[model samples]
Target: MSTHRPLRIVFAGTPEFAADHLAALLNSDHEVVAVYTQPDRKAGRGKKLQPSAVKQLALEHAIAVEQPEKLNTALAQQQLAEYRPDVMVVVAYGLLLPEPILTTPKYGCINVHGSLLPRWRGAAPIQRSIWAGDEASGVAVMQMEKGLDTGPVLHVERCAIDAQETSASLYKKLAQLGPRALVTTLDDIESYRERAEVQNHDAATYAKKLSKDEGKIDWSDATQLERNVRAFNPWPFAWFELPGGKPGQRTVKVHQASVSQTDHRSAPGTIIDCSPAGITVACSQGALTLHSLQLPGKKPLPVSDLLNGYATTFAIGVNLTNVD
Candidate 1:
C-alpha cells in the first residue's frame, strides 16, 4: 500500500481482541510493515500447536509475522530495527515491552486496554468489571511506557455495563470500540486532546487471571449475585456440590442463574423451591433462581429439562453446603 506519507507501523497483539484492531489497521490508509505476536503454543485437548488470532490474520494478509520467545534478546531487537517503524500499535501483546522496544518506534507505542484506565489496570479487566458490578467500563488508548498499563491516555471510548452482561459479550463490544477510538485519535494526531489521568494505586485492585478452581461456586459464602454465575459463564463455570451417593458422587454446575430479592430464607445453598419457572435456592442475602445447569459429563440443560425425568429429590428446608 502506497500513500502520500506512508506510516511504517509495527503491530503487536495475540488474541481475538487484538485481531479486531489489526483488521482495522490493515484496511486503513497506513502501511503495516510488520506484525509481532506471541509464539505458538499447544491448545485444545490434543495439545496441537496453535497460532494466535492475530498471527492467523497476519498470515492471510501476507504480512511478515514474528513469534519471538522474548523481545529483550539481541536478535529480537535487531529484527525490530530492520522495520524502522514510525509507530507501534499494541493490544494485549502478552509479553511486556522493555525500554528498548518501546523507544524503537519514533512516536513510541500505543496500547489498547480493555478497561477505563485508573481502574482494573491489570490482566482480566473485562471479567473483573462484571464481577465487581461496575456501572460502566470501556477501552483506553494510551501512550505505552515501561510501567504496567500506566501510560498517558491518548483517547477513550466508554460503554455501559449492563446488569446481565458477561465477559465474553463485553469483550466483543470493547474490541470494536477500541479501533474506532484509535482511528479517531489518529485522524487528528496534531490537534487530538489527550486525557491522561494518574491511577489511584491505593484504590486500585488486581483481577488475577482466573483459575479452574475459581469456578467452584461456594453457595454458603457467596451472595446470589456476587457468586456471579453468569459472569463465570462459558469459562470457569459456577459449580455446586450435590448429595453424596456411592463412590464418586456427582456434582452440578450452574450454567445460568437469575437474581431476586425474596423474603423467603433458609441456609445458604438450600433448595427452597423448584417449579416449572425455575429452581429457587437460598443465598447469603437473597434467593437465587437457577435457570440452567449441567451434570458431570453432560451438556448444559435448562432447569425444566433436568426436572422432567431427572427429577431432583430436593427436600424443603434441607441445609445444603459444599465443602472442599
Candidate 2:
C-alpha cells in the first residue's frame, strides 16, 4: 500500500499510447477524477463512428468522460474547473491544452512524452527515432508548457532500439515505458519539479507526422532504405511500384526486409535474384532482401509464397520504381 495521500488527477489522452498511461494511473494510488479524450472519429472501411482508445477505456472504468472539441472554450474551461484537479496527466492527447486548462490544476499539467526530451520532440517521436537510426529511444515525464514538447524533464527511462524494430513495435515498447515513468514522477511530484531542467532548444528536432509519400523507397542508400522498411511499418509502410502490363503501376507494400550483403553494380531497384532465400533487389550501394510483402488488395505473404504463384512479377531483370 502507498503511504502518501492520493493525488487528484485529470487525465487527457486519445490514442492507445495515452490510454495505456491512463490504465496505469487507474491501477495506481492517484485518483483520476475525470478523463478527457478527443471526440469520436469515423474509422475503417465502413466509416462507422468509433470512440478513441482513451474514451473506450475511460467508459469501461466508469470515469466521467469529457470530449470537448476544444478546451479553450468557456464552457469546456468551466467543465474542467469543476473537477478541481490537483494535476493533469497528458499523454498522446491530440489537442493542445490552452493556458486556461494548463493553469487550472494546482501543479499545472505534466506529460508522458514518447522521447527523451531535447531530441525528437514533436508529433511522431517513435517513428522519427527509428527513421533516424537512433540506437536507443526512451520516454520522458515532463512539466508541460507552451512550446511543442519543449517541457522541462522530470524523469526519463531509456530503451535500446532493436536491429529490426519498427514504428509499430517500438511504439508499444515506449507506451509501456511511459506510464512507469509517470507513476514514479507522480509518487513525489515536488522533487521532480525542482529537479527538472530546461531543454536545449538549439538541439531540438521536430518529428513531423508522417505522410504516404515519405514511404516511397529510394534504393540508392541501402541504410536509408533499410531504415524506411522498419521505421514506417504498420503506417505509410515502405512501398514500391511495378509496371502493370500495359499501363498503370502495381503498388506493393514491403512488410519485412533486411540489408543484403550481395555485391552488385546493377541499377537500383533491379531484381537481381528471386528465390527461396528472398527477393534480392540490387540497390545503388548494396541490396535489400524483401522477406515479406503485400500486393495491392492481397494479404501479406513471404517471398517464397509469391514465387509459387506470382513468379512473373518477381522475375529477374524487372525493375521496381515509383516512376511510370
Candidate 3:
C-alpha cells in the first residue's frame, strides 16, 4: 500500500505460524526475493527429517529457500546482501538476527511477535499468556532490533482470550491476525516506522520457554492446575506420574480439565469420584474434574470413552498427585 516502489522482501521464519504469514505475503503484490528457514530436522516417531512449514510453502511458490544455521556469520550476511532486499519480514524465526542483519535492508527488518510489546517478550509468549490467565492477548508488528522482542511497535491487533482458550487455540488466532496487521503497517511503512512507540523496558516480563518438567501438574492450587491443563496442551501436555502402575510407574496426560467445587476432605491427589462426567481429583483448595486424558502412546479420549476401556485407571481413593 506504500506509495513508494514495490518492496523486494526477504522472508525469514520456520514454524507453521510463520508460514501462514509468508503464505499471505506471497499472495500480495510485493516480491519475496528469498526465504530463510531452519534446516529440516527429524520429527515424529520415525524421526524423519522434516522441512519447516515455511520451507514447504516457499518451495510450492518456487521462491528461493536458504537454511543457514547461523545468520550472524559473515557468509550468511553477504548472501543476504546479494539479494539487495528493500526490507525483511521475520516471524517466529527461532534464530536471532544479529544487529548487522537487522540493519542491513533499507527499510530494516520487521517482526510479527505473538504478544503485545513489553509483555511476554521472550519465547513461548502464547503459552505464557494462557498460563498467566490473561483476559486478552494479541500480536505486535515491530521494527526489528538487537534485543529480544524489544523493538518499537508499528502496529498491534488485540483479541479477547476465551476462558477455555488453550495455547493451541490462541496460537492460531494470533497467526491469522498478525499478517493482516503487518500488511497494513507496510502500506505506509516509513510513516508508521517514524511514529513507532518505543517499548517500556521496565514493564517487560520474559515468557520463559515451556518445558516438559513444568507440565507435571502441581495440585497445590486447583485454579493453577486447570490453567496448566489448558496452557500445556498440544505439546508437553499436562501430565502426572503415578507411583504404582503396571510398570511401577505410569505417566498420564490430562488433555481437558476444569476446576471443581465438589466438597471433598480427602488429601490432594485423591480420586474423589469417577463418573460419566469426569474423574474428580481433590486438590489443595478444591477439586479438578479431568474431562479428557491420554495414556502413553494412546490417543486423547473423553473420560466416558476411557472409562469403557480402563475403568480401573481412575479408581476412587487412588492418589493421582505424583509430579515427575
For candidate 1, give the lDDT.
0.79
Q: Candidate 1's residue-wise lDDT over 286-323, tens digit each?
A: 77778888877788889887888666555555545743
lDDT of 2 by residue, 117-172 (tens): 88989888999999999999999898888778888998999999999899999998
TM-score per prediction, in order, is 0.90, 0.95, 0.95
Residue 214, candidate 2: C-alpha displacement in angstroms: 0.4
Off by over 4 Å in 2: 1-3, 245-249
Model 2 C-alpha lDDT versus the unseen true structure? 0.89
Q: Candidate 3: deviation at residue 318, Å?
A: 1.3
Better of 1 and 2 by TM-score: 2
* lDDT of every predicted structure (CA atoms): 0.79, 0.89, 0.89
* Consecutive 10-residue window with the lowest summed lDDT within model 2: 242-251
Clash totals for all candidate models: 0, 0, 0
lDDT of 3 by residue, 1-324 (tens): 356447899999999999999988887778899999999999999999999999999999899999999988999999999999989999988898998898899999999999987899998999999999999999999998888888899999999999999999999899889999887777678888888999999999899998899998767788988999899988888998765656424888999999998998999899999998999999888999999988877888999999998778678988876433
Error of 1 at 263 (Å): 2.4
